[model samples]
Target: MPPALTSGWSRVLQGERVLGEADSILKFVPYSDCKQGCSGMLYVTNFKLAFLTADRSSYDNTGKRNRSKILGDDDIPLTNIDSIYTVSLSGKRKKMTVDSKMPTTETLEVHCKDMRIVKYGFKFAPKDQNKKFVNTLIHHAFAKKDTLLFAYEYGRSNELKDRELICDCPMFDTIIDWEDELQRCKANKTWRVADVNMSFDMSQSLPRYFVVPTALMNNDIQKAASHFSDRRIPIWCYTHINGNSLLRMSAQDSDTDQPREVSRMLDAVKVASNQRNKPKIVKVEEKCPSCQEVQESFVKLRKICMSDTMQEFSNQDAVWNTSLENTRWLLLVSRCLAACNEVAEEVTGGKRTVVIQERTGWDLSCLVSSVSQVLLDPHYRTLAGFQGLVQKEWVRMGHPFQRYLSLVTVSEADTEQVPIFLLFLDCIWQLLIQYPAAFEFTETYLTTIWDSAYIGLFDTFLFNNDHQRYHFSRNEGKNIKQFKLPSVWKWDFQLGSEDFSFFKNPLYLITHDEELVSSLNELQVLSIQGMFCRSSRNNSFTTSLEQNRNHSQDARPERIDPLKKDLLVPNCSSLSIRLWTQCYLRWQSPAQILSGGTPTQYLQQCVMVEEIAQLHHKLKTLQLRESLFVEFRSKNDLIVSHQPNKSKISELLNSTALSSSFPFSPGPALKEKQFSFTPICSYIRNSSLDYDKYVDDDWTGTL
Candidate 1:
C-alpha cells in the first residue's frame, strides 16, 4: 500500500473494514516529528482510528507534497487510549520553551493502559491545532469505547471482530418512551421536545450524546448560523401540570463571542420559563484586554499589588506552590455545586428554565442535573424511574467510567480521574439514608451501582457518547440473538427488598400528595468513604419506615456524653456501606497492617463525639497551662495591657468562648442534629408573639 493513497491532501480511504457505510472522515491533519523527521496522516474512521505513515517526499494526486507514501504499520488501536490531552503552543512563555526553527507542532499525549501504561505522543502540524485534535481523539475514543462495552457485556471476547452490532438505535427509550407517555397523559400539549427528561445538551462543550434533561434542537431555531444547522443534541424537557424545568447539559462554549449560540440557549430555556420576558446573560465579571506594554507593566508592578498567596517562586517552596495550583479544580467544583443548589431553588420554570452550568455541562453536568432532578422531581426517586435515571444520565450522558476503572487499584496517576459519579452517588446515599422506603431499591442497589461504576458490570454505563453507543449496541456487532443480554435490574427481581436491608439508608422521603418544594439548604455535600464507615448512633437492623420516621422526627437533643454505641460497637469495613472507598480505594490508599494480627482491618476508626470529648478533656488536663498574663486594651486608651486575674481567670479560661480560640477542642462537640431549640429566624422575630408583649429584649444591634 503506497502511503500517498492513504494520506496527503488528496489521500482517500475505501473504508472496507468499517461495517456498512462509514461516516465521512470529516477532518485530517499531517502529523510529523521535527526531531525524528517522521510523518503520518491522522485520520479517524467511524469504527476505528488509523494513522498512515507518510514519506516526507510526499506528492499526491492533489500535488500537495513532493512524494507521499503510506506505511500500514503506523495505524494505532483507538481502543487502548485511556485519556488524551494537548499542550499549549501559544504565548511568549510557551515559545521560549521550544526551538524557534522547529515546525509549528502540537504535542498530543495519549495515555494507553491495560496491565501497564503505554504513552503515545504525536506532533501534528500547526500550533494550537491541539484543541481540535483532543476533541476528535476523545470523541473517537468514546465511540470505540462504546463498541468495546457492548461487546464485553454480550459475552463477546476481545477477539470477536466477526460479531455484528444489532440495535443501531438509542439506549433505553427515555426520550421516545417519555414522548409516548406524555402524549397519552395529556392530549392538549405538543411535546415535540422529544426526551427533555433525558438527553445531551448540545452546547459546544457537550458534543457527545448523553442523558440530558431533554435534547434541544439548535438547527430548528437558527438557519442563518453555520454551526447551528441540523444540530439536534440532547436538551430534553420534562413538564408537569404544576411546573416544568429544562435541565440541560452542554459542551463548553466554542465561539466565546457568538450571540447566535447564546440566543439559541436562551430561547430553549425560555420554553420552560415562567417569566413574561426572556432571561439575559448576567455578566458576573469584566476584564480589560491589555497590550504587551501594559502586560509587562503589570508584571513589574506585581510586587506592589498582588494576592497574599503570591510570592517569589523558589525550589525550596516549590512543593507548596505546586499543590496550590493543583487544588484549583477541586475548589472550583465545590463552589459550583454550592452555587447550583441555590439556582435549583430559584428556577422560574413557570416562565424560564433555570440554567445552571453543570461544571461546564459534561461529566459533572450529568451529575448536577440528575441530583437536581432527584431533589425537584419525585419521579426520579421511584424504582422504575431511578433505573431510567441512571440509564439516561450516567449511561447516556457520558461519564467515562472506563478511565476511572484504573482508579480501583493504586496508580501513580490520579489527576485524570474525577469523582463526579462517586460524589453524585454520595449525594443520593444521603437522600437514601434520610428517606429509605421512598426508593424502590435498597442500600444494596446503591452499593451495586457504586461497585459497577468501578467494575465493568454493565456496558450501558461505560460508553463515552450516545450516538455511537446507540449504533454499537444495536447494529454494529454480529451476534446470536437468542443469548440476549439480561436487564441490569435482574438482581431486583431475584432478591426482593427483604434480604438487602443491611444496604438501606436510614432516611426516607415519603412522596407528598401535593407537590412540595424541597429546601435548598438540605442539599448538603458529603465525603467519600471506601474502606471504612463513620459510626452511626442508630444500630438497629433496618426497622420499619414508621419506626424510623418517628425517631427521626423526635425533637430530643443528643447528649454530649459519650453513648454506649461508641464503646460497644467495633469499626466495620466500608464494603458494607461505601463500595468505592473500601475496595476501589485499595490502590491509592494502602490498608494499614493493624497490631492485632488480623489480615483485614476496619475501614475507619469509630470516632464518636462523646469519645472525642473525653479525649479532649484528657489532653486539656495534660496541655493546659496557667497563663501568667492576658492581653487587653484599656477602654479609653487604645493600648493593650497584660494583667493576671487568678481565680476568675481560671474559670474564664475553661469557658467555651475562651477555649474555642484553642487549636484543638475535645469537649462534647455540638452538632445540628443535637440542637432541639427552634431557630430564631427572621420570621420568628416578627411573629404575633411581639417583643412588646414580653420584657424589652436585649438587642445586639441598635435599630
Candidate 2:
C-alpha cells in the first residue's frame, strides 16, 4: 500500500535518501501570512540535504534603524531562500605570487521576472519538506517583507512518490496529466506538441516534445496495433495522443469496392491493347477489261440473264444445265452485298449496315449459309445479318448462312467465280442503302472485304458508268487506274442524288479556257469518241442518200450520166466528198447552224453548197484550193467532145493543198461534165492538228 501523504512529506524532510540521481531542484518561497500569522518562508532541497532561511525580523523594533540592523536577514522565511545556485567549491584555491596568475571560473546569470505564484491543491512530491508547511510557520513570525508560495512537483516518479504531500496553500487549479491533456488537445485539433528545446544559446536548449496517440506507448505499440498507427505521417505512430481513435475508426469504415473497379478498368485497357493488328493489302484480280466493258454495255445484264435462266428452267423443255446458271442471281447479289458492306465499314466506325432490296430477280437465297456462319461466331454473329422478307414462302429463301457455305464450296470448285463475287458486292451495297442500322453493325466486316477485294475496282466501276468521260492507264502492266472512279459518278453516289444537279445547276456553272477532264477513265473517253464518230457517219450517210434521191428524179442528161456512174461504179469520190462534208459539219458551231430550226431539203442543199463555197475561198487564200471554171460553147455541146480523164481526177485527189486534210486513205473519183470541177481530196496524216491560230493569238507565232 502507499504511505499516507503527511508521513511521506516527513520522511523527505528527515533527509532520507531518494531513488535515482537527483538532477532537478524544487524551491518554495512564501510571501503572504498564514491564518496563524506567518511572515515569509523559503525551502530548498538538493540531492543530499534540504535547507531553509530562518526568520529573524523583530516586530517591536524602533523606527530609526542602523544600516547593520537593516542588512540583517530578518524578514526571510525558513522556506524562502534569497537565491538557489549550483556550487562546485571543492579543494582550496591555489594561491599565486605576483609572477603567477589567479584561477578564474565563468558564471552565467538567470533572471526570473513576473514571479506571481498561485497555490496548488495536490502535490506529487513532498513539501515542508512540505515547503507550504514551513512557509506558513515562517510567515506568522515576520511582517516586514512580502513572499509567495506555490505548489510544484519535481524529480523522477520514484522520488516524487516517496515525497508525496497534501498542499496546504489555497488550491488555484487542479493538477492535470499533461500527456493526456496534450492528446485530447491534438485530437480536437486545438493543440500541437512544440519542441521548446531549440534556442539560440547552447546552454538553454530543452528536450524535444513529441505528439502521439495515447494508445501508443512506444514505437513498437504502433507497429503491433494497426489502430494506433497514422497512415499520413512517416512515423509508425500518431504524433498526437488523442488521434488514435479517429484514425482507427476511419480505417475500419473504409470501402473495399474501389480496387475492384480499378482492376476492371485496367483489364479493359489491356484487352484493347492486345486486340489491334496491323493491316495488310490483298490483291484480287476479279474482272478483266473485256468482262467489265461487256457488263457496262449491258447494264443490269446479270438480272436479265437470271430471268432468262429462270424462265428456261421453268419451261422444262430440256434439262440442259439448269442449275449451272440457276444460282447466278444469288451469287451476284452476294457480291453486291459484300462490296456495300466493305464500303460502309470504311466510312463508318464499324457501325454501318448493309441492306439488300427484296426483289425476285435478285435471288438472295445464297446468303443463308453466310448469315449462319456469322451467327455462329459470337463476335461477328451480331455484326451482320439479313432482312426484308415480304413473302411468307420466301421467309427462309436467302439464308446468309447457307449462301456462305455454298460460296466456300463454289470457290474451292471453280476459279471463275468472279462474276458471282461481284454480284455479291452489289447485293451488299443495296443492303447498305436499305438498312442503315444493320450496315453500321457490319461496318468492320464490310471494311475487311473491301480492303481485300473492292479497293482496286473503284476506277473500273466508274469507267463502266461513263467511260467516255474518263481515261485509264496501267502502271508496271498492272491496272493502276482500276480504282480511279469518275468524279461525277463518285459525286452522284456521295451526294445521293441521281440527277447530279451539283454539276449541272446554273448556279454552280464551271468554266475554263480549255477544260481537260483529267480524272476521266480512258475507256470512257474512247467510248464517247466512238459514239460521236458513229453519229457523224450516220448523218453524212443520210445526207448523201438525200442528195442521191434528189438527183434521181431530175431527168436531165447530165444528171442521168451522174446517176448511171453512181449506180455502175459506186463512186469513191462521192463517198470521200460525203465524209469530208460530214467532217466539216461536225466542226461547225451547232449554235450557229442549228439556230435556223429544221431546214427544207432544198434549203439544206443550198446551205451545204454555200458552206463549201466559203471553205473553198478560205483554202484558196491558204494556197490549198484550186478552181477549174469553163463556159460551154452550147448547152448540148454535141456528144462528149472532151471527156474528163482519170489522170485529172487523180491529180486532184493526190493534191496535199487542202485547208484540213483527212487522216485516212482516199478513194477514186468519176468524170462528170465537159467542164469538170474536181476539188482536191488528200488524207491529213499528221498526228496533231494545229488549230491554235483559229482559237487564240497566244499560239500565233509558235504554230
Candidate 3:
C-alpha cells in the first residue's frame, strides 16, 4: 500500500496539544510541490496546516543513519486558506485565463483570499489518490472554527467548493431546536460576546417578526444554506422585543401563489431547489429604460398607491382604460402591502415573530423586514442608528450592491439598478414630512445616499453585499476585523449635533403619552415597497426646498431664535452653488494646470462640497425647527411637543473619547438592552475606591 496518510513524520503528530483540536486527525499529504513552490509534503496537524520539505539534516533516532524529516526553514502555514478545489477540464473556465493547461492532468487550485489562487499540479501517481487529496483538503478546510472561520465562511468559498457538513461539532444551547443548517458561529478567544446584561432568556414567540433575544438564534439562513449538504435553513432571525421580529422575502406572483405540497418528495425538492435564491437580500429586477433620473422616485409617494381604496375606484367605468390598468395594478399592490403592514404591526406590536417570504424571499421581504425595524426601534430613528440599520440589515447582510450599481459606468439602463433602496428612502421621506423630528437625518441625507451610492466613493457601500464583498476581500488577503467594516459616516458626524434630531415620527409624535408606536399612514406603507414612477402632472407634494424658499423672508435671522446662530446649516438645494464657488476658488490659470483637471482641484472641490453639505444640513435643521417652534407658532401641537435634544446638540463638533465612562442606557424602547462600544466603556467592572489608583504598566483595565 502507499505511504500511510500520517507516515514519514519525524515525530508523532500530537494534534490535541495544538489549539483544542484534540480529537482532530493529523493528516499528511505528500506531493512534489505546490504552485507557490512549496516542495515537500503538507502536514496538517491540529495547530496548523504546514508544508514541510524533506529534511536532509536527518537526526538518527536509533543510532542508525536513518533519513528522517525535521522542521524546514521555510514552511508555509495553510491556516488562512479561502478555497481549494480540483480543476477538472470543466469546459475550459468561467472567465478567460491567460495561462495554458493540459485537459488531462488535474490541478489542485488553492485560492487564498489575501493572495492569488495558487495552482499545484497533483503528482500523486494515482488519480484516485489525487481526488481523495483534494476532497480531504476541502473537508478540513471549511469545518474550522478558528479566529479566521467567520472571514473564511463569509469572505471565501466563492468558487463553490463543496462542503458536506458532518454534524460532529456540538450545537449551541440556543440552536437545539433549529435546523442543522443553522449552525452557530465558532467562538474565538479574541472576539467579545454581547454584554451579559443585554442577553436574556428569550423563550417567547409571536406572529410578528422580533429580534431573537439569544445569540446564535439569528442567522443568514439562506446564505448559510448554500454552504451545507442540506440546502435548508431556518429564517434569518434578529433580536426583538417579546422575542418576535418580521422578515420580508419575495414570493411568486398571484398566479402561482401557493405550493402544491401534495406532490411527491422529488417534485417538491425540485420546486424548492428552483427557489433557492429566495430570501433575496436585495431587490433584483430584469428589464428597463436606457436612462434613469432622480425625478422618477416620486410615483411611490402617491396617496392612492398605499391606501386600499383602489377597489372602490375600480367600480367606475374609467377602470377599463388600459392606462388605468397600471394604476389599478399599483392599487392592488398597495392593498397587499397594507395587509402585510397590518400583519407586521400586529406581530411587531404583539408577541409574534413573523416571516414574510415571497416566491424567492427577496424584494418585498427586504422591504417589510427592514421597514419593521424602523417602525419598532426608536434607536433607528436617529441618524447614527439609521446608518447602523442599513449596515446591519442591507450591506452587512448581503443585498447584491455590486449588481445594482455598475462600478465601471457612471450610469446605466433604468432597469439595471433596483430602486428597492430608493423606495425605502422615499418611505422615509414621507415619514420625515409627517414626523419632522423622528429621524435625525433629513431628506438631504437620503438624497446623498442615492447620489453617492452608485459612485463607489466609500468602501462600505462599494461591495455588492457583505458576503460577496468580504468573500472577495478574503480572496485578496484583506484584514478581516471581526464586527467591523468600512463605514461612510465619520466619527465626527456620528457624535455631532448635525445628525441629531429630537422630533418623533408622526405616530409617536402625537401620542407620546401612550404606546411607543400606534399607527402609520397606509400610503407611506405602500411607498416603502415598489418602483414607483408617477406622471409629473400628478406629482403634488412640493419639495421642502421650494417650500422654504417661498417663506425665506419669514425665516430671517431677526425673527428666529438667536440660538439658531450656533447652527451652521444652509439650504440643501444650495449645494450646487457651493460646488461652483468651491471649484472657482482653486482656479489656477489653465496654463498652470494641464488641460485636464489637477488632483489639487479635485480634492479642493470635494472639501468645499462637504463644507456646503454640512452647512445645508444645519440650515435645513434650523429651518425645520423654526418652522415648527417659531414660524408655525400658531400650531400649538408643534410648539408644545418639541423635545429638547440636549444630548445631540452638546457635541456637534466634539470627539468621543474612549476612556470616558458613563452609565449607558439603550433608550426607552430597548430599556433592558446594553450597547457595545469596543474602544469605549460604559461602566467599570471594578467598583473599589482603589480601582483608579493603579496606573502602571500592569493596570490590567479594559475599556
Candidate ranking under lDDT, highest first, comes to: 1, 3, 2
Q: Local error of candidate 3 at 414, Å?
A: 8.8
The residue ranges of model 3 lying beyond 4 angstroms of the native Cα positions read 1-232, 237-240, 248-340, 348-351, 408-415, 474-485, 491-703
Candidate 2's TM-score reads: 0.15
Is candidate 1 or 3 superior in lDDT?
A: 1
Q: Which is the winner by TM-score between candidate 1 and candidate 3?
A: 1
Per-residue alpha-carbon lDDT of candidate 1 for residues 1-703, written as tens digits (9 for 90 to 100): 3344344332232221322111111122212122222345455433234443454423333211111111122333344344544434551112211112333324444433221111233433433543344455555454323334323434332222222322322244444654553553241243353332123343222223222222245344333223332232325434333344445534334554545655565565554434455642211111111122222332322222211111322321356434433433223333333433443444422344454343233455566566656654556775556766676666654555554443222233422344456556655654554444445444445655554443233455444555444444554645534223323444332232222222322233221211110220121113243111122332322232233332232213364122211111111122222222222211110111112111011100111211222233334444433544322221110001011222222222232111111101111213223322221122122333222212112211222
- Name model 1 segments beyond 4 Å from true: 1-150, 153-176, 180-190, 195-234, 237-244, 249-265, 271-274, 279-336, 348-351, 358-360, 403-416, 430-444, 474-484, 492-703
RMSD of each: 24.7, 55.4, 23.9
Residue range 111-159, candidate 2, lDDT tens digits: 1110112111112233223333323322322112111111011111122
Question: Which one wins on lDDT?
Answer: 1
**Evaluation by TM-score, superior candidate among 2 and 3:** 3
Task: Report, for every candidate in turn, its global Cα lDDT versus the true structure.
Answer: 0.35, 0.23, 0.32
RMSD of 3: 23.9
Ranking by TM-score: 1, 3, 2
- Models 1 onward score TM values of 0.40, 0.15, 0.32
